[model samples]
Target chain A: MRRVAITGAGTINPLGHSVQATQQAMRDGVCGIGELDIRDVERLSIRLGGQVKGYDPDSRFNRQQLALFDRFTQFTLVAAEEAIAQSGLDFDGGLAAESGVVLGTSGGGLNTQDENYRAVYEEGKNRVHPFIVPKLMNNAAASHVSMRFNLKGPSFTVATACASSNHAMGQAFWLIRGGAAKVIVTGGSESMLCFGGVKAWEGLRVMSKDACRPFSANRNGMVQGEGAGVFVFEDYDHAKARSANILAEVVGFSMTSDAADIVMPSQDGAARAISGALKDAGINAEQVGYINAHGTGTAANDKTECAAVSNVFGHHANEVLISSTKSMHGHLIGGTGAVELLACLMALKDGVIAPTIGYQEPDPECALDVVPNEAREASVAYVLSNAFAFGGLNAVLALKKA
Target chain B: MSENVKDRVIQIIAEQAVLEPADVSMDQSLSDLGVDSMGLVEAIFAIEESFDITVPFNANEPEKSDFDISSVASVVAAVEQFVAEKSA
Candidate 1:
């Protein structure tokens, strides 16, 4: 297996569109949650959500590209453009044609689906939009990215609910390690702010009526959010040969299945993923200094994640500084792991750990020091980002200082 | 429809659109207050729920609205007209 390094990254999130702006917002402890502004579904009780503001799809793609891609795919393409520019790789060159593209998304083209439904049902229209098929599929985002950059190597979209991005990133890391591709553009995208998407979650009954308060005593449920985070992963030596800027090393990745309830999370499942990543990296549990938690601000998730940490690290759990960006950005579903991983990498690079905002009162079940509300400067060598999704899917990624 | 029914419908539209009680008047267009045609559809939905009446949309009508509906008096007249037609 070959060592993989992160060459570039881009994000379109609530804090801001660029990666720098997002990190600053995290350090400043700004909350992006606001009242929902989606069309036609205002009567729903759950009104608060974190939406990516001021995004113009017209600016991202040309008319021809827009006709074939969905909104999620458009987000992927836009984010990938930023990442590709940062990597300084020439996509038209043969080198990039062999490179691959893999992305993850839970609600792909949900906005398009809702629109199509309304057209057929409410408007009494029979003919569907020509782009409906391409817009509604999970793999469309990856396909669009590959075509946009002319990448020819293995490419696909991973769908494991919230853990989708972790799975996508993990697969991309392995592709390079296995010598299948020298470079891979991998990440996740989500646009669940659409009225139908919001209404679907409303049926789940797990979304908070108020704001997201992760690991807080007053926490009710998870808050929905939308965005995309993309990364360019290349072979360490390949990046060095080209004098590419290395952000952080993708040390190891591990995934596990809960094999139990579909909606409920399990500490054992999460612990197994942590242990697997540590084993893969050949690092002791004590070597890891920080954790980017999959803290969804829900009653069950925060407690289960804490227990999972305790089960894996034992006494070292207290020494480790943990935080959740979800408290600031809300839960971005498939995009959460990618965004949180960037936070972990930034923490390892800059030594400034992002805060878990809105944590006023701590839950006794969650005993770890969550670095609440205020960003703290700490020495971090190895950081782990955890993404445990619905249906017991768990994925973990470890990033080391480059 | 009775004047009280018209008033109730107008009140629901005003509240749903986040407008002031006095801002909504008869002959005033809803689109001028940033409530576009789709917003008007949602406003009608809310009003229907509040008044326990089903407000129907004319399929042949143009997508865009031509008037301003900022004041309650004007909105009341529009709802009254729709209600009277439905009953007839």
Candidate 2:
């Protein structure tokens, strides 16, 4: 069987615009969350968010392109550009026809939909933008990436809520490993930090007004974040042939469904997925040096994840380093796993484990070595990135040092 | 609390828990009635609509909410208070 290599990784998140900046911020344990300065801040009970600061689409995209691109699509394209550029592989002829795009997003073009809805209901307007449908569609980002990069094989978007990105990246990894495609631009992007977006999330009452402190006993809930993370998953031999810079190897991935609860996470479901990924990689739990936890800072998610980790790793639970970068960048929802995967890459390639910043008093229930609020300098071989979504969907990806 | 208000609130809670109003008891908590977190939120929404009142309940910190959901009777009392305040 063919192997997959992550040749390029890019991100435009709340922590920073580029992967380098994000890596540094994570290493320094920077808190990207703060008082959200959105359009309707006064209306939301949850005021704080990990909003992507200092980004202007006017400077990046042309007037014509801006009209067609939604906030999510724009973020995806920006990150995709960085990823494709880093990969140093020009898509032409055979490559262009084979390479594909797979992206994940829950609220695809949510900003576009929000504005149009506001115009119709609040403003009492009959007319809206012409490109609304094309811009707000779930597959818009994936289609745009494919069109921009001339990737023609299998292009689609997966929307499993928070697990979307991991599922997308896992599909990319398998596509290359199964000989369906040589390379796939796979990741996720989400821009749902708008009024309607946050307002909708507020209804669920799972948002934090102050901060996101995953694995902390005093943690309140998740803070919304907006951004994109993209990676080029290429065949190991193909990447090696071109002398490409291999960031990490995509060793294994496993997805599971609870089929039990709609919102609450299932411990058995999560444990199965975690152990399944380890089994898929054919690696022992002792070999796993780090885990980028799906720690959303909510009391339920944090405790459940800790239980699952403990169940899977047993006595080694306290040995392997684990942290949730979500505490730093906030929960990006659909795009979260893609951004968290960057932490796995960092752990494998850089040997510096990202910290789960904002950790306060640790709960006895969640008593695992959660790496706390400081980045650790640990030489790690295999690392796992976990994403457990609200719909009882879980996706775990295992990576190894390339 | 008004008898009608109490009966309506109990009915809402019972429906949320997938039980009959006769099966629901005033002393029972929402959890005792098998009303999960999502069910409670839905019940709260239904209560608001029925009584035309805004619930001050925050799912994050339920105990901190002015609207008590500890028992069926408490929820009815809270709803009646909110309804009276809205009318006043």
Candidate 3:
């Protein structure tokens, strides 16, 4: 198998609109959680969220184009634009045709589906909108991304709840490693922060009351966030041939299904995933310098994930740095892993470990070195990004300094 | 009252259902556009939600066998009738 390298990455997150801004915010230990600015919050219990500020679709797409895409697809396009630009690899020749896209999301076009349903049912309308079907499909983001850049290879969106983006990126890395595609624009985007979407999530009862304090003793639940995180993945040889601006090398990818429960997570599944990723990379547990944990700040996730990490790394668990960026950026759901991967890449390159911002009093169960509330400066060669979602889906990726 | 109701109802219907402003004339047949039974139900839901008014009668099941809900005028009249019944 060929080695895969991350040439570029981009994110439209709550902390910042771009990768550089978000990384700086992470380094400064800045938290992006704030009061909800949505139109109607009085109807919902959890009003606060990590919504991306100043995201105007009209800024990127024309009126006609905007009519065709949902907010999620619009975000995917915006993030992909930045990723392509930063990759420093022009697709003017045959490269464009060989490139593909694999995007992910849990609830594809939930807002669009809800709106269309409301329009048809409440407004006494007979004819549905022409763009409703196109907007509501799960593959809309990947299709739009591929079409925009003239990428002719395989394109699809993986839907594995919160693990969707990690699964998408993992598959993209494998495809490039297997020499199926020269480059893959892979990531996840979500904008399901509308009234209907929030109401549905409220049913889950995992929303935080105060804020998302991952690994904190007082951590209530995960805070919902909306944004996009995309990365350009190419074979090491291909990227080196073009002298592309390499960001980090994807050393290993591992994904597993717990097969036990849909909502409940398992420590064994997470440990297996971590061990499998280390084995895939031909590296031992000691080589992993940092772990971008899936600490969703929820009661079950933080404790189970911490146990899983301790099981895999043993004594090194206390020595290795672990942090949950979700504390700062809120839970991006499908986009969480993509943004977290970018954080891992930044940590590997800059040697600055991002803090688990909301960590106040650490839970005894989560006894690992969570890097606490302050960002730690340390040289890291390899970093792990983990994402475990509902339906017991687990995806882990290993990244090395390029 | 007839003109105002027709104009307001038609605009809301067109915008919600994504119909062309011109296509939502007073005489267009909604059923002809392949928007069968479910479409009618959704149209009622949107009308109620957007206008912040509940239409009279259980939209869950329709008693009328052959109500024409295709045009702007018919929908306006239906909503007005539903409104009047609730008010009475």
The runs of at least 3 residues in candidate 2 whose Cα sits more than 4 Å from the true structure, single-residue gaps closed, are B1-4, B20-23, B51-53, B80-88
How should the candidates be ordered by lDDT, best one leading?
Answer: 2, 1, 3
Q: Alpha carbon lDDT of residue A56, candidate 3? A: 74
Supply the DockQ value of model 1: 0.02
Q: Could you list the chain B TM-scores for each candidate?
A: 0.58, 0.94, 0.59
Candidate 2 per-residue C-alpha lDDT over A1-402 given as tens digits, one digit per residue, 9 for 90 to 100 = 899999988899999999999999999999999998988789877788999999999999999999999999999998999998999988988898779999999999999999999999999999998999999999999999998989999999999999999999999988999999999999999999999999888778778877899988888789989999999999999999989999999999999999998899999999999999999999989999999999998878989999999999999998988899999999999999998888888888889999988888979988988889999999999999999988899999999999
How much lDDT does candidate 1 score? 0.83
Residues A1-402 of candidate 3 have per-residue lDDT tens digits of 888988888889888989999999999988888888764678877787898988777777898997888888888888898998898866668988778999989888878987877778877788787888898888999998888888888678999999999999999988888888989999998888888888777655567756888888777788999889999998899889888878899999899889988787899999999998998888988999999999988778989999999999989998999999998888888888888877798789999999998778868988889988899889988889999989899999998998
Model 1 quality (TM-score): 0.81
Give the winner by TM-score: 2
Model 3, retained fraction of real contacts?
0.00
Clashing residue pairs in candidate 2 (N, C-alpha, C atoms within 3 angstroms): none
lDDT of 1 by residue, A18-135 (tens): 8888999988999988888888756666789988889887876778877777777777777888888999987677776569988989988888898899899989999996778877
| Share of reference contacts found in each model | 0.00, 0.35, 0.00
Ranking by TM-score: 2, 1, 3
- For model 1, the superposed segments whose C-alpha errors exceed 4 Å read B1-88
Q: How many backbone clashes does candidate 3 have?
A: 17
| Candidate 2 displacement at residue A310 in angstroms | 0.8
- Quote each prediction's TM-score: 0.81, 0.96, 0.81
